[model samples]
Target: MGPRKITAHGDKGAEVQGKIRRLGSWRRAAAMIVAVGTVWAGTVMPASADTDLPEYLTKMRAPEMWKVADGTGITVAVIDSGVKDLPELEGRVLPGVSFMEPPVSRPEEKYPVHDDFEGHGTSMIAAIVGDGSGGGPHGLAPGAKVMPIRTSIGSPMAFGAIGEAGKGVRYAADNGAKIINLSIGGWWSLDRIGPAIEYAQSKGVLVFVGMGNDGSKMSNPIAALPGAFGVGAVDINGEPLESSSNGSATDFAAFGGKVPIRCKKNTAWCMQDGGTSYATSLASASAALVWSAHPDWTANQVARVLLQTAGGPVDGAKRNDWVGYGIARPSKVLIDRQGDPGAPDTDPLASPTPQPSTPSADPAAAVPPQAESTAAESDRSWKWPALGAAVAVILGLGITGILKRRRR
Candidate 1:
């Protein structure tokens, strides 16, 4: 069984402040280019021109993993801002489709499929499959190819296009993409993308999503979904990042604190940034490595191995809201030969069904017979309050106004 769900603890004022800070960063990026739940920490400050392999690669033991598998035959579709053809990712990014029109500011460009104005998707691509040419950041799985899918999420708009994001997920599934990396999330519900994620799962594709950076008690909609593997962020010490979101939806954690990335304003140097987006990318690359090594393994088996090999929570729980199965350790499977491949069709992370309860036969019960309730009744009892709490959290996040505006 998965670990029991735990309630998140933090200062309410601090959470609100963090949410404001996160929204401010998104708006700033949107000013230059559009954004969805890109989960970028924004270049806080410049770092030395040290373009060495990121600490995360070492943490995940990517070098050791590469000795066994480098994801040579796998394709990870990045569904977000388009990917740029940087030297680090040259010949690795496929010519992906764009569901949105070209940026109004860049009409001269016929195809915005490769235009990464926000630089979010480009960084994500480099994080997944960069070859480290010209002293750029080295990706975790350098042999994996990236498929870029452009959408309004990367545009200079305010709100995200949920419908377009859904379409992008479906497109990646229909294409040759074996893994779809959706490092995007939002304050609003992701109901629109549910069916598309389901479609991908049906096609033997694994989808990885980022748990947002608002420091909220619950994960964003994308991560909250079942078919998607929700990823959170951890620092070098393997502790959850301070800004990382947590909830029942979080599936795993990865190095997301101050990892190396090509500076957005200047590609000549590398800078340190952090976010759940990077964590998601690293998790997706970890899956790619395992998938490449075991090409014949079904998606379910690959997922099961990941769950089996993951590091347990610090509290000794089977899982937790903050880190889910725990930190991703692909090297365990690649080098140590750990984790069971398990059944080909069973999803290791699937929620367990609650067994029905039967009435006690003892006549010495002190409570009246009318006090007895069926299991379904007990289940329904918590449903409304849980839902009400969720709604309250959304309203507190200022999403109610957005929903009302959209309805208009």
Candidate 2:
């Protein structure tokens, strides 16, 4: 995640800051945004007579690679907060659905969609496929279309949140979305969402998830879910940010810090937005670019190529804890023609086969009589602390916003 200081409105600032502090170390894990006037290192593009690319784009060589693949004919599903009708995303976003209603709902009313309440989803959508009109930052996959699915106004942590996320995944898969970008996550299990993830995988949909901003820990549940590609954040210099979460589940890293984002209210752009959320969007767009160029390739093949060609340290490690396979280098696959698109049907994750869990016929066979005393002892001491942390982060943080005007 990017470095940001939370500034609540008016008198609520102290209360919000106090609550944020109660989250303990998790406060540092919250998704971050750049303050309005901050300038990150290696992000100042030279002024030119012609339009100059955003620093992150130029560093990633997006323009040079655009000639090879621009994510044409691809649809990326952004399942987060609602996506607004931002000028940059005017024609690229498709009509989507909302899962924010109560569990028991009557069929009389229509749920709202395509209206971003917190402005997080719109920023994410812009990162994936904004057309860069009005001198806005160009998305990695400007030619790709986006399907905006509203799961929550802020974080996707409402009641039955997992079920809503599962439903969103299914909807995207059914609607011909090639890539599903989940920029929000929590510390929940995958049990509720497993079937939906399987459904997407079966439909050849590549699902990319944010690895969270919790450094050095694999805390977020979505990152551990099989078939979900966990993305981490890196700086313009291709180094993993210290705040970026790290674990075995982290699949790849992409430029997240100092990336340009559309502002929440005005038409101006912000250059300081960052976190695994933005990185996930870029990775999703990269997948779209590869898949669009190789129309014949299956999701598995595209995923394989991305992993194979990703750039990393000279040590030659297959995967690192912070960056996984390493920073996503779509240029290597698209322009350099590196990496082989392996077998289409074979799963790149290669998850282990599940074994049946048939129980014994005996009534008392599951537990030993001697361990009954210990089994009844409940040690839930961590719940209250963890819940407090979760609440603080869920209420305060989100995808970082964009800033600044393009230089010419």
Which candidate gets the maximum TM-score versus the true structure? 1
Cα lDDT of model 2 by residue, 95-155, tens digit:
8888755434454644477756556677788888877765555788988999988864343
Off by over 4 Å in 2: 1-50, 102-111, 153-160, 262-268, 351-408
lDDT of each: 0.64, 0.62
Task: Assess candidate 2 and give its TM-score to the true structure.
Answer: 0.72
Local distance difference test, candidate 2: 0.62
Q: What are the models' TM-scores?
A: 0.74, 0.72
Name the regions of candidate 1 deviating beyond 4 angstroms.
1-51, 102-111, 187-189, 265-269, 351-408
Give lDDT tens digits, candidate 1, residues 1-408.
343344332342343344334433332222211121333333533433435566667667778789999989999999877877777788788889876554468766554678766667777888898877666668888898899988655444414444567888999999999999987765423455766787788899999988766554435555545478888877776767655666656777777777555454334434554467888998899999999999999888887777776765644456666677777778878998987787777665553311111112211101111121111111100011233234423433453222211000
